[model samples]
Target: MSGSDDQSGLLVLGPLLRYVDETSASVWVETREPATVTVQRGTDSASARTFAVHGHHYALVELDGLQPGTTQAYTVAVDGATVWPEVASPFPAPVIATLERGRPLRLAFGSCRTSVSHDKRGNETHGVDAMRAWALEMAGQVQPADPDDPDLDPSRVPDLVLFLGDQVYADETTDAMRAFIESRRDIDQAPWTELKDYEEYAHLYALAWSDPANRWLLSTVPSAMIFDDHDIRDDWNTSQDWRRKMEATSWWHGRIVAGLASYWVYQHLGNMSPSQRAQDELYAQVLAHEGDDELDFGDLIDAFADRVDQQPQTYRWSYTRDFDTQARLVVVDSRAARQLDPDDRAMLDRDEAAWLDEQLRGDVDHLLVGTSLPFLLARGLHHLEAFSEALAQGAWGDRGARMGEKLRQTVDLEHWGAFQNSFQQLAHQTIDVAAGRRGRAPSTVTFLSGDVHHSYVSEAWPVEPGRHVESTILQAVCSPIRNPLSRNMRFATAVLSYGIAGPVGRLASRSTRVPDPPLDWHYAEGPWFDNNLACLQLDGPSLRMWWVTGEVHDGDHERPRLAKVASYALDADGNPPPREGTVSKLRRRLRPR
Candidate 1:
């Protein structure tokens, strides 16, 4: 049966390529009914029956025994009937290209997309969707080249797309989401604009991924994802006070349960490798159920999600992948893994921090640390957050602490800088790796992050002069794949990130009891507020990074063209050399269209 056949009771969401290795691959899909899903690549195929969760049916089919480094076209079938590639798929057919030994990794990473129509209204209000524009460009549908711009080579397409966080914003509902929520419940009630249940979340994912261009891109590109605060709520688990406030709400239990549960099925499950999936107790149960009858895991999954919410120590959301000898991608769970105790605020709890420390060793050419919240914020913002944390912890006194706590939540000062203890621990660990005290120092220790709705590159240096660190430590941030901060907010961000705020912030922190920072850093590229996506290319000893945003040309808003915002390169030692020009000249060259 064809995928579009309403009577087929077959595929609904995807035949999305998930994790892939040299010998195995995993494809995820949702169905209208419980059925066996199969993935075939050449003569080899793998099948898995759908498991029901609250009446929603899904399966992750595994394809194994593929040749290393081989690229093979794949097909999806539901209940022994071919369904995908939909006969008229306009783009290239989906394929699985396993990671080859010694091949340099090229990755596209971005965060924070809002689901809306791709018409003029949506384009004007939300800016064009960067992922959709890139996908169109990649598919050879739209190509606008500039003489000064870097070449757009289809052959060098990224092997994977890392969705850093905010994959779906549960708190900041789009108009379509609000309409869906209102259809089911009273709009005037508590949590009026936020998602309420697994049903709502499923609909949100459908809206987020269902766009034709993006859907095609996701089908072909393997994806890895993690959640940020917006995936549950704005400032989710920000502090002990925030948690207490949320817990007091009438619908919080339901919201948290649904958020975590939906995240597991839609994003987290696909993030795991085959071996990791085998180790998961819940997935093991799915595998152990051998009967032809469909398996229902609704109640069990609900209970599991509740348990995880109540005791996050029971689960591990962070994952690591090593790309042969090229690089190691350590995608961290920063939001859910927080320890918000007033006495000991931490970005990651002890267990999670320990796991992260263990993963920070070096052996490859580069180490990429992916956290939704930028590890190194603008220097000024870093000091401000650190100062806020100290005041919130009663560093000055009880009254000051109360005022600080209020300001902290109000201003959303809860990144790594706010969690001083955890930040210090990670900083020390990263320093050790860079200093070659832990392992063979890579060319660079790069922190890949988003969540702040702007893009930038920053380089950090040791506090002591003449400190010999072999690895270049840098921070790369790309955000808001579709969402854009308001003009007023952008002005505020620019002032705080680039102007007098740095010295002022340091003074503010010194006025409080906040300790001195372990290191220092400055912006190397930008603090640009654009709805953009970033590409990171590791080619042998060189690394290139660039940001691209969709720009409307000649009033053609519906078909926005991709435009380069800024580009930077790191030499063999991962150092971005300063350009020999005036600041005005540099700005003129890098400014967005």
Candidate 2:
């Protein structure tokens, strides 16, 4: 049903335990009407009511007066009706999970999934949605886990899910969305029959979230997401030139405003921890209400979107969370915090850069920086960006700029290297963290990324000690949870990048008397391309990263299975000495068949 068609219905987001503190935590959701949101201790009939809040569709039911390091079952009640089922699938309903000090965390993260029906396959081009498949298995519906293996419990789930980017595609709306558009507007228009207003965005969200498996997953699993280019449009914020072109378009303004505004309502608000949301202007207003009255945030949302598009520095697209002393996760918004000026271009503007620098703290066992696009591009791709940037600035003039523009338009080469200044700044930050400038050196400073339609891991060699250099760091990229790479483009990228780009970049850097990123800073742990899902586990001071994909044999019966595509582990010794060729070969052996 369209979002407008179903306004009065149950929408439960959490017993998701966000911002869990010594005694209280916040639970948030979007509901039809203001109702009494309740949290209980055990099952649906549990007598211990943790907390209750009234009126607001979004509730932060702070479970105050609770003991720490304890496990308790919780449920939500609206107007004396238990919203959560007594028995939840894959496990038990209102299962008791704990909050304790110094626990190991398992985080599942991926991006670029389209909202399609779980029932049918319209085209076999890219294959089924990897996320829905995974969620299905987790729900004990499609690919149920082994029954005899008692060690596996459905009640025990991952702590949080990190969605890097492209959670929804406004440009590539689903068939259902198209149908709605076809009924309402003309497809012969310039921008065609894509999303146009809040109504459309709401429908898009419903399609994205309504999948039973993913919906259940979201209800229990707290998730954090940041937008990418596709979340708005492909190659968004590539350069000021691109922005100027878009601004001249007839529909660009409404599209951007609607995109950002809907993002605030559908995604960004849920991303913030309770404490963080309190600082948000919209949420603050939401917090003040106490009846079943509709809290209209139209003005606030519109204003916030305008301010962000006009002045990105006013708010950061980055956030950091500490997983006790074990790990620190920093999710950065690469698209929003960009300086697109050709003269002084940087991936991140001053404010965002400074904020990111501050967040790259030390002393954590593992530091995970989640940038939607990998900060470290492939050697060949990196060279192309450098080459084009140089070419654009030199006597080549319009030709050079046009070449760069064409590459960005047809090929996605606009990454960290495109904005040289910001790349250098981040490089400095990585080097400093590795050199133990922040605090005790982390076991690994891992940059987790998704967006390139393939998965790979790269390691940056530490500048030698006592040689005025920096310590080693790593970057892991997992992409396109459903989108698969075409063979021709893959081969082209390989040829243009690794084969031709490297040597050219080196020669150009030396000839022009300009510094180039060190050659020692490059090595790939994977080149495995497929529609995939990646998981990372932290065991003590050690780190394990792997990618999985579904195997097909012409029928729908073969459900998605976890096949190891690539795996990387940081040595527990707290030092990543240049293994050089060692990790690359190992990764190749571990790659998916």
Candidate 3:
């Protein structure tokens, strides 16, 4: 149903381009009130009536019958009146370019952004937002002479932006979030600075995505997203002990419900293909409802979120998208679909693990695995986490186990390494695929990850001398599109990740009866703490990655330019050897500009 005249107020947040395929696209938007929204592409259009959850109105308009391999400009309207591309828009009109067959895909990805103003104060605190710099660069470029040109221009827009995790921080509430919370409830009361309910989450999203520059970029580029611990709380689902402790709290139920329900509406709902959305129960209800009235989904969504959290097997947040024969993007739900059983802790539950195993098979030239947590952390950190897990499980007797639990929680030693069984299973699967045992091996089996607050590239190798994997096994991490680690933390991370802690951790783990890892890896590029964004290009049999951050120039804080931090190129053979003097050179180059 489309609205006719009689709508009030501009859009509160987006007209974000979500999932896009060859013939269809999904665009999500938020409005100040209940209104029918429409997205128009050339002469084709799609419309949907807004639905209400906690008094906020939203709609996801699905555009179908789009031509493959064509770029079309689009506009958004509310209640029959155009609301987007305001009079004198600084940038070009928003567009959605559908993917074509047999084309190399270029994707940009990053994670961990804090909501703050873009003025001098905010830039000083969090560094200039790399996303804003990227958006500006894209805007400055003239329309490409040939859209399908593979190596056309570095400024040419990417096909999609994969936001791995921590899209918003519920625990580390910004000043704007805190102000909104204080206005509604007593600051001294429970749930204090963090978000308390769906209403607050709605506001937080507005704060995060409302900036005009980033908003326009989001509207034009297709995006896929997943949540990390900070989306609900720091160390969410860290362990059964942590889970029990949180469950006992008065506000934990409301927080989780709000977090998951809001995530479904704002992020996950748009990540699915039309066929996938058709199978969703809640989405089916949305489709069935008729007329112009706002459909209230608060109670239904709350119930759904509660059920999914309690029995994770009932729903799957993970999704796999195949881009013709070029590549396959498998985005895993690392946070929710976890087996926290003390005796058999795993990163993925039984059903989720089986699903991932199936998805790990190969035929395409490149296989991209998107998980919020990095699969292969620095060897030192990996060994330390494994040791901690073993000690927590009483590998060193009862007294050691108690201390281990405390240390685990304190140090946040919870990644793939902490869940030994799941890590080993996935490693074996990856090894098989890389060895061509599962299927035709891809040139690269690259793991795209974020959430560590720093960026780096690592390559894994089988331990045995003669054992060889045909495909390159790599971990590429980009984090904190706006947030940067503190100075002390950065120092510690560099010390540990650069080989100081590996030997010590291995010795400790040996004493604790923790088994050795099947493969060993090292940092090939960086442990840089700059707030940055990374772009990966897969062209034929080669994979290239480059990291860029915003750099202020000539006392101009607001208009920062994009500066390249580093670049790495890997051929079909595997990752190139690290440049001889790269460590010292990169450390100098990456210092805060």
Which candidate's TM-score is highest?
Answer: 1
lDDT of 3 by residue, 337-389 (tens): 99999898999999999999999988888899999999999778888888988
- Native-to-model Cα distance after best TM-score fit, residue 281 in candidate 2, in Å: 2.0
- What's the ranking of the predictions by TM-score, best on top? 1, 3, 2
Question: RMSD in Å for candidate 1, one decimal?
Answer: 2.1
Clashing pairs in 2: 55-291, 88-93, 380-497, 462-471, 462-472, 463-470
Error of 2 at 533 (Å): 1.8
Clashes found in each candidate (C-alpha, N, C closer than 3 A): 0, 6, 0
Q: Report the lDDT of model 2 for residue 527.
A: 63
Query: What residue runs in model 2 are displaced by over 4 Å at the alpha carbon?
Result: 1-8, 12-25, 33-36, 41-73, 86-98, 119-123, 142-156, 290-292, 463-472, 496-501, 508-514, 552-554, 575-593
Instruction: Tell me which of candidates 1 and 3 scores higher on TM-score.
Output: 1
- Candidate 1 wrongly placed segments (more than 4 Å): 1-9, 147-151, 580-593
Q: What is the TM-score of each candidate against the true structure?
A: 0.96, 0.86, 0.95
Model 2 lDDT tens row, 117-210? 5443632655566666566556665533343432223343666778889888889877888998788789789578677766676667777776
Candidate 1 per-residue lDDT over residues 119-153, each given as its tens digit: 88898788889998888878777774452455455
Model 3: per-residue Cα lDDT at residue 115: 79
Off by over 4 Å in 3: 1-8, 141-154, 572-578
